[model samples]
Target: MTQLVGSLPPRWILRDPYAHQKGIPRFPRVVATVLAARGITTRPQAEAFYRPHLLPEYDPLLLPGMPEALRRVERAIEQRETIALFGDFDVDGVTSIAILHEGLAPLGAATIPYIPDRFSEGYGLNLGAIRTLADAGATLLITADCGISSVTEVAYANELGLDVIILDHHTVPEVLPPALAAINPKRIDSPYPFDELAACGVAYRFLQVLYEHLGRAFDDTAFIDLAALGTVVDVAPLIDENRRIVTRGLEAMRAGLRPGLQALARVSGVAPERFTAETLGFALGPRMNAAGRLAHANLALQLLLAPTAAAAATLAEQLNALNRERQRQTEEATALAEELLGPEDAPLLFVASEHISPGIVGLVASRLAERRNRPAVVLSRGPEESRASARSVPGFDIVVAIRKEKALLVRHGGHRSAAGFTVRNENLELLRDRLIATAAEQLGCQPAARVIEVDAQASLADLDGLEIKGLMAFEPTGHGNRKPVLLSRGVELREARPVGADRSHLRLTLRDGRVTWRGIAFRQAEADLDARVDIVYSLQRDLRGDGVELEVLDIAPAAAARPLEIRTG
Candidate 1:
């Protein structure tokens, strides 16, 4: 047994020896440690986190104006009013549109799904799109994933005599839009319990309320799968209400309900039984997003709703090809943007070029932000106005910074960490200066380096059957609920080598005494590290039938500081 160090909480080393003695239902030690660190102490809370349910505990009427919104939707459903779902072009927007269409189609309501082209019409509720929907005989207009800050566009829809219901999760403006019913958790006056729901989650709640009003019980299992996709892809917190939706959604995805989703799983080589958070984020989500990033996002939407396997296969293949093209473009653009920076360090980075595509500026900005550990903005020169995407570090609020310079922007809106805006080509320099000043003011005197939170320190001998089984309690980790990162010191390195064709990963053998483990670090082969190192990682079973292997996240030289004492039984 290892001894406990000073100031280290004794409970940190107290693993439930009988955790997995009962059956496979035993909670994994790593899972319990992570949950405990995040304030999830009770068994009931852990169970609720792992298996989310759309129970009667939550009431949609709690949302500001939800009752009125439901009343209007109920009226539209009863009268068979022509409803048009105006959605954004991203995955969340597409999934939200599909949810509303499928939920209302069986009620004899005629619904038209309209998604604006990212390159052509840009974002949000445009006056032209509204006019078109009204001309098509749409009496009720429903906006999803967008329209929270569209004060002007909503006024246009109201003037056209269109009854509008807005379901969105973006930040609310100072003055609310004058729509018939605006359903958003961000509303200052909203009484909704949870505020971290994604746009699709908001739409899902609206459907739930609609079902209740119609006195009908709708099976939402199939839709939950899509909800999971949008929620995870959109990077929503996997806790509280979102946890339930994602947990159930993953189950639905594994059961394989929709033809398109099943076909996507097959094409991506992701077995349903072997699915994990990585598969959704790295494999499935990117392919779906590819359609919107390069070409028409409607292709992905159509694929999701595809009724035939043959149709799904064709659409999936097309999306795959588009994804490949997107990768090539992204790589070229990122390399060029990096070259422009040289060695200059600013509070923020602003890169503009005629070669960059407006469709992928956001992705490029995100990558640059991660690499530089500072706020980054990537711009594509438009004919009249230049468009830019902004990504920020955790401590800085880029959206708020952009909003302070609202006088210089034609349009701008997004979350605190990520935002986008359009400005006149002549104002690019002014915008850059204003953004840097705003960041300096808001972020204080010095920018803070990123910090990694570790759950506990462990020796290789501590990773026994009991600890591994206890960690299994926390499944489906993402966003808000992250997997616990364990730091182990004095790890003797046996061998290390580059793996993968591109040499993007590192495979290493770490040992302490007779306990030896093989670990693989993804995308960290090029990182500077000595032969002997301290590693922070999450242990997972490979389960590939070739036996289990440990996966490492971060590795650095073992410092000469005081050693961590551990008490093990």
Candidate 2:
């Protein structure tokens, strides 16, 4: 039997009973409990949570630097100054550039969208790219998704007589770059109620303010699609204003996908009517990001900016090929990284390799962090320098930890959960030691036991009336919002067999009373289980799309001699 996390079984934490109090609309006990778990106990809260259209619009000007950013943009437009849209080489950056270009171009602003090559320029605002944009007669440079920490690059731009405006959402450093306007909701002085907007969301908000300043109504339908794409791809929390953006954006997408996205959807084999947040996150986002991860991000930008369906189709096919290659490369790199990992139970998982692609180090780090339930750092080592990407488990602030050792780093910036830094090869080991010690003080030396938060406990028969429509009302579930998980106890495991290409998954037939449910547990083929089990799972549409199936999260022996303890909070 493969022990869960080597020794510790996953702790089951049941939802707090206080959230189940009255005031919420009458729903199935399971559904109501799930809503309460999410703090939607009020009628209005439920409405806004379920139907994002009901949420009130937040004022775009609430951001700290909004007024200054608006002024600079207005001045550039009035003077017909060419503005360069420099963005990061990811979905968030690509979509940010696309949104700004589409919004500003119609208002008589000459915008040139530029995404630096991931392989050559690395990340953020590079001096060479800044010099190139300046030489191209661009008097104004608007950096999307990045540039929050480019003090040196911004200074260079200023020397070339070009004003810079930053639209980003990364964690802000104590000393910000000297840009004309640094508009980011994460700024310490920001008054914005929600600070989790993706870079494209910030760009969209900027456009809203710009259009209002020009005495024109902002057409959200024109650009919300791109904003939503970036938000999901960047893993921004799906709450508050972000929820509204994705909800409306999804409606817009189903009504009509842009020519570029339409082509991508076709190539991805998803019908427009079937497009959901999952499609964006799982299908479209990966394909779009593949270009930046394995090749030049300009390919993705071209697909988004394709004027005709034919042009979009060609570009979409290329991105599809790139995505496949990216998957292969990531798999190979992850396997190599696992081999290099010193110990599975280390406080922090840090591995450096010349085999890992710098562009995919973040993805590799994310995988290791999830698998080990610890903070993970993956570095792509070059001759003299190494670029590292780190992913942290909940409760750990990776960027904050990395910031403490900035003396040895050339440049570093990112959010609490994810961060990246460039460091000299000689200091790599010392930096790793410092980070591991910091993580150990916080996370302990051993891997913490994984915990599964159960929204409700139910029998298989109780879910017979659970309509797929009602369950699916929880659309756009990711990051901050997650699909509800249910615990079904004392179920008979009638049949279990390995499935999938490598037989790495378990296909299960479970029964409680007279009701039977089919379930699939991924990567659990070797899990030794009792004939009867208590399973924690989420309900989802089966591959056939006609009925529901259990996507099991965890399982334990049924009716143990001593009933398994369930912790309630």
Candidate 3:
């Protein structure tokens, strides 16, 4: 996984074993070892981890302003007041808009969904946009995936005789907005249970509470599927209620139930029965996000709002084509950013160019940070202002770093791992310097190392039928609840060759005593497979409907300290 051509290999750290010292009825050994490595020691925790449940969702009324927001929405429904939903331009934002609009549609509410242009309006509330919405006869303005940090815009909305309800999940800014209801779980004073919910999760909770308040029963889980899409797409942790939401959502999605999903699956070449977290996060999410990143997000929103199968199929095709274009642009932008970086010793990297699009800065930064293993800030410079997207390593909090430089920024907000901001072109130097200094303080002058973690050291015998079924118990895997990565030593590489059109992947046959395992390592076409190796891998079903295959993450020659006799093709 360490791709730097001449760099020393990263130290692989296997997770330490759990005590199980209390003699707590030692679990089915192999499965217990995996579960214990992930911190699920108790039997009840194991049960909850294995079987995710959505029953008895936390009360949304516990949210600081949810009850008040519900009351206002109820009144709006009774009086038939015009309502507008202001949403962000990403998949989470799009799904939030769809969920809220669909949730309120049956109540005779006059709802209009509005997504701001990425180039023109950027993110969150703006006074001009508020004036436009109010002018368009919107008496009530509800924000989805945004508006928590728009203190000024909310104040203006209030002055224009428009009641605003802000439903967001981003880290709260110091100064709160004066909206009629700002219902973010991350509020400093909030008593609501969980704070890690994606924006769409919050929106779903609100709707669920509203349904109860209206004396309505909704066992229909189609909406949960929407929430699940937004949650996984936004990279929300799949733990606790988030796990339940995604698991149930995946169940609904794989059933080929929702029109939007069915059409999207058809265009994306996803067989519904085979849908999983991988399909959602890698395939569907990126296509939906492609429209938002390259053009207007309303195209993605329209796909969700599509009524007919043909219309949905057409929108999905459009998005698929746009995604191809996005990939090309992203490759160009990433190469540009890499070319602009300084020496390799720097703890942080900041790259700016007019060549990169404001919409794609986040994508570029994410790629740079993941590849080079550090915080990266990619800026797209405009004539007057520049938009910067920041992505950080696991330990550093990029959001906190961005917050420290707020005085030099026009606007900034995001979670720990990712963030975005706008800065005046002239203040770019000051912003850059401050951010560099902050990263140094947060991460130290020493560089962050690239490390691939292994969950446990295992032998081929450990992966029996019991372990396989136990592993399957932990379904709907993604962020937080990740699939385990195991390392096995001294595996004989019987045969290896490059696969794929670009010859970027290695298809290998590995042997363990009498048993044999088939595997593929991504981006390791030139790997040194001539020598016996230790492999880091995950167990997965073969793509060809065969039994289990090993998905190789990395391979290190058996003798680590000794020089490798690598073959040069």
Candidate 4:
């Protein structure tokens, strides 16, 4: 690949053999090895991992603040109160609002789904929105994907005779908001077994409990797809409850997508049967987010809640246009960020410019962070204040680092790996300096190289039949859980050349003994391939209807590769 200056080469780490491999003897050797690597060593564990619906479903009532939130929702329905559903402009937030609105409307709740304008309101609950809702006869205000840190805003809502219920999954602050019920699994005293649900997941669970309390059977098949979309798009860890939700949701989607999603899939050129975590992250998620990034999130939300195919198709096309514009803007912003960064290496990358849009700062930060292998902060400088987004490397906690300088911030909240904040222009330079010093103290002069974990070492022949099928069991992989990588040594590279319109991808033909395979290495067009090389790859469906193909991740010249020590402890 075209290596960036100061970027460290990726370190390959092969996992040690699973200690309890013998417990899952029913699986093929390769399948068992890969399953064991993921901690599924027993038959029951394997069954549950492969068929997630077999896993135990935690009681929604166990979630912290569930009872209060549920009872308040019931009361609002009974009284026919106008409930204002406030959500963030992101996919998770929009999906959360859609779930609550669709679920509650059938029960006689007068719902007003509202997403703040990205330019005027930024993120979370704003005083102006609350006042507007109150004026429009909204007695109950429920926030999705936001409001956990909106202590002042919640108090203001309470003053306006509006009862606020916060449904959020972000990192909670030290002091709780004054909402009627602040529902989040991250609470210190939360009894909920899983703490990693996306905001949409939380909204889904609330509806489940609400339905049961009202003696109605909640249809998971109808709503799980939205939950899955939000979970994958928000980059929530795909384990435990999240795995089950996505597994079931994908099944439902394959069975048949809702009208809105059907139109969206048609526009995105994705078949429902081919739905995977990658589909949500790369296709649907970005398109949904593009509406908010370039225009208004309501456009995307309307598409999600569209009741007819005809209406949805037009909205989907509009969103597709917005997504294209968003992609162009992000590319321009990323290029500007690179230019501003120049040819230097720093413990942290910080760039601020009026040219960058507030909506695309997060995307810019994410791109720079991945390219430079360190934490990155990108800010769109407003006249008096700047909106900033921060993305971090695997081990670095970007939000925690930002929280240290909360005194300089107007508002900030997010997960460990990602965060956003608003800062007065006067404090921007000092905040950047302090953050750089903090990162330097922890990361030293240069950040460590990224590591790619390999599940097993297998020949090209070993990855066939049951082995390929077993690998398919790791579907819907993204973020925390990824497709397993296999290493094959000294494979003959028959051909290698740049592909794609932009020549950013490599098309390769390789052979191992009598078996031959075609591979594509994305964004690695500049990698110098050898005639005989060690290749690290994952199996993926061949889009051309040819069976399976290798998604090459990395390559090295023959036996020159010296991997890091295997972890045995």
Candidate 5:
């Protein structure tokens, strides 16, 4: 019988040394490996990456409909029109809402922000909501983070004598919406240089262009900070303009110019100076997303718009409480999912239940996919239709698999790793079987072993405080650019003991030759005990004011360390 957990070894792909090559600007070996792995080839490219800058000009305005969108918005601003900002119910949507609300305030427009209910309205635009916005004295409706696929809804808005402007970043549908202007970089006719901007990113750029169109001087310092939050929370690739946005945004955030972010950091126990991509990914983003997942995203948007520190702190506390509930819901849903699909080796894992929260099914799929090392779809079933969120492994595209079953789905769309769909209760079983066969065909007969790519090989002696600090230049890590993973060979463990409340984490003092370093491995209680072992880890500054420490990714006995097969997408 196979054990509940598989024991396949991880594949390590270390980058070859490139700093020694002629014409390449020389950096430390480990830093060079990180750059090389990220494909930073030229000297200018390295310099630009080392000191990334916010773009000085507009690139998003190049999208096909952006010019017209700006013109409509400028006319609305001149007329002091009542504009409604429709947003989704997530961190990205909330942040985008805040940015556009602030962006339009100085332009003499009365902006009303509307975040659809996750349970009631589902994902995108609904006709009833459109009527509600119009009744609220909104003559113009602009959608952020959603509305790219709202074809019939836009036509209805037009019929109601409301001009619609869409600021979205999702994959464009076969037929575009009938909005006055739909600005999506992914549109088939879009000429935007970059197509991966998060919804708030698109909103921020639109503000920049709108200012330009009105002949106004725009200082983008604060709007970019909001955009950075959405970009990081959306897990958009940290490249091109995203790199510029986050890199500079962190600096602006530390300045505490934005009252909401400052208060959020204070209540979240994060020092402004220490905020980074990792901080957003783990601490702040979850709290911002928690309200959207559990109760209402308005609470989060309120935090951003909080007028004073006291108000922001109060809202932050509320959001923090909501986040705790979201965590509990996620844990319950994941346990239920695991129980339903016990000890199975299916290519794709599918689970539908009333136990999962509609807002958290995507998170459940992510958690299951990471654990099972296979594509997972978790559905929160409703009476007439079931909403399913799917997450995929590194190689297989879950969105493509979902597309194959389009005939059975009401609607579905997402990127390669993640997607969602609404299917009737009756079609759920057929959807599962279709995906199983699709997974078998797209992925080979047998799934490849899970792989962990090492970024470089370094000795304990090589990882000084300065080396670790130098590597910190690789800030704002996510999606395309991740924190570097380095391997240290044959390190003897001087002391090892279980840590953390559940005793699932390992705290270690490791020695290699005469050099010693502290290390911690989260949830590594099952690690094999060995006198000497090769450990793959990432470097971080020691919180105790010590030099540096290692965050172990994986550990194996020196003798047992061997290569695993590489599977490419």
Candidate 6:
């Protein structure tokens, strides 16, 4: 047994006896215990968390100007007006466009889909694109995943006699865009109870309201799959309504109704029979995202909407190629960004290069934030304007921080954790200074670095098949729900050796008395293990043909003594 580096806070384990006695199932004692630790003790609350309702119970009109938006959509439906969907190039944007298109297409309304080139057009509504759509006889313009911050572009569209309806979920700027109807939950005047919906979620709700207004009977399940794909890929919280959407979406995906999704699953080596959240987030999301990051996002969008098996297969192969190219580009850009840092003492990292794709700056920013444990902003210099992406630690809202420096940015918007902006080359320094100063004032100090949290304490003897089965119950872990990491103390490292081609993996053994378990730590061959140590790990069956072994997340030296103290709440 090994003691892990981190321990669960005592407050998380101690629970109220009264709540436990109120008939909570303890068979999944750890589940109940953890839930109680998180302050969820009642049956109803647990049910809500574990099994979320996919259908919206809140009034759709609660969304800011949603009623007005519905009116416009209903009019377009009745008149058979040519409506154009303007969307971003990412997964959320693509899925939003598809959902709206699917929702309106069957209503005998003419709908056109348009995606801006990330390199040429940048993000959000552009005057050139709007004019082009107008030229194509589109009278009504609906935007998804974007347009919340396109104040000027929306005004331009309105000036051109184009009726614009905005459906978006991003940080609301101080001044609202001048669209005919702006449907956003983040608007300060919004009556919507929850403000955490993703872009696709907002689009779904908008369609739901429009369908209701039109008295159209549409199958809500048809869009759940797309909703789930977008929610999971966008990294939205898998709680509340999002949980319901993803849960049902995963079920639908497993059933293999959509040829495109099935083709993706086949090519990506994800068995439909064994689909889970991990498959969505890890296996599929990246592949789809790769298209946007490296090449045309239309490839991924086409794959998702492909009607025929042969078409899906062809698109899947194309997407696979794009993903490979994305990997190569990401590696190169990440290396360059790291080298650019070169021991800077700045509280924030602002790195820019002309070679990096603007579509992937956000991804690079995320990696930098993880490696440096600071807010990271990455930019790609465009000919006319420079585009940037920002990612931040907890407690620091990058979008809000960027908004505070709006004078230095030409355009900017995003969520609390991540954001994107564009600025002129001359204003880069000013933007950086303003963002740093704002962060210092708002955060007070650098946010605490992310720390590993152990779900339960374990010993080497507990690393059994039954324990592994128990862990499986916590499926589909992500932003809100995470995989449990257990810490074991005083683990005897019987042997250790390098395994990978680059000698980055460590294959070792942990033994306590007669109980011994084989363990492998990826990219941890360099870690020091001269003495007995604690290991934070997840138990996994290796299934390497002959047999299976366990995997270790991290192995660090055990504390000098066990800090043992227990108290009941």
Q: Pick the candidate with the highest lDDT.
A: 4
Estimated TM-score for each candidate: 0.91, 0.96, 0.95, 0.97, 0.95, 0.88
Model 1 weakest 10-residue run by lDDT: 2-11
Ranking by lDDT: 4, 2, 3, 5, 1, 6
Q: By TM-score, how accurate is candidate 3?
A: 0.95
lDDT of all the models against the reference?
A: 0.79, 0.87, 0.83, 0.89, 0.82, 0.77
CA error at residue 505 for candidate 4, angstroms: 0.7
RMSD of each: 6.3, 2.2, 4.0, 2.0, 2.2, 4.8
What are the per-residue Cα lDDT tens digits for candidate 3 across 344-380?
A: 5456788889999988899999998877778999999
Summing lDDT over every window of 10 consecutive residues in candidate 3, give the lowest-scoring window. 560-569
lDDT of 4 by residue, 1-569 (tens): 33453355577887655533443676777777777777778888877778888877899888778899889889999988999999999999999999998999878899999999989989888999999999999999999999999999999999999999999999988999998999998888889999999999999999998999999978888799999999999999998899998888998999999998999999999889888888999999999999998899999899999999999999999999999999999999999999998865688999999999999999999999888888999999999999999999876788889989999999999999999999999998899999999999888765467677888877876676888888877887887678978888889999989989899998999998888999999888777577888888998878754478999988878757656447654
Q: Per-residue lDDT tens digits of candidate 2, residues 1-569?
A: 22325346667777664555642566766677778877777777787888888767788888877888888888899999999999999999999999999999888899989999977888899999999998999999999999999999999999999999999999999999999899999998888889999999999999988999988888989999999999998999988888888888999999999899999999899887777777899999999999998889999999988999999999999999999999899989999998787456688889999999998999999988877788999999999999999999987899999999999999888999999999999999999999999999998885687777777776767774653455667887788887887778878999999999889999999988887889999878877689888888888777766677899988777755313345633
How many clashes show up per model? 12, 0, 0, 1, 0, 12
Residue 282, model 1, lDDT: 71
**Candidate number with greatest TM-score:** 4
Question: Between 2 and 5, whose TM-score is larger?
Answer: 2
TM-score pick, better of 2 and 6? 2
lDDT of 5 by residue, 178-238 (tens): 9888888888787777888899999999898888788888988858888998899888899
- Give residue 443's lDDT in candidate 3 (0 to 100): 77
Task: Give me the runs in candidate 6 sitting further than 4 Å from their true place.
Answer: 1-27, 54-56, 442-449, 458-471, 492-501, 507-522, 530-532, 538-551, 559-569
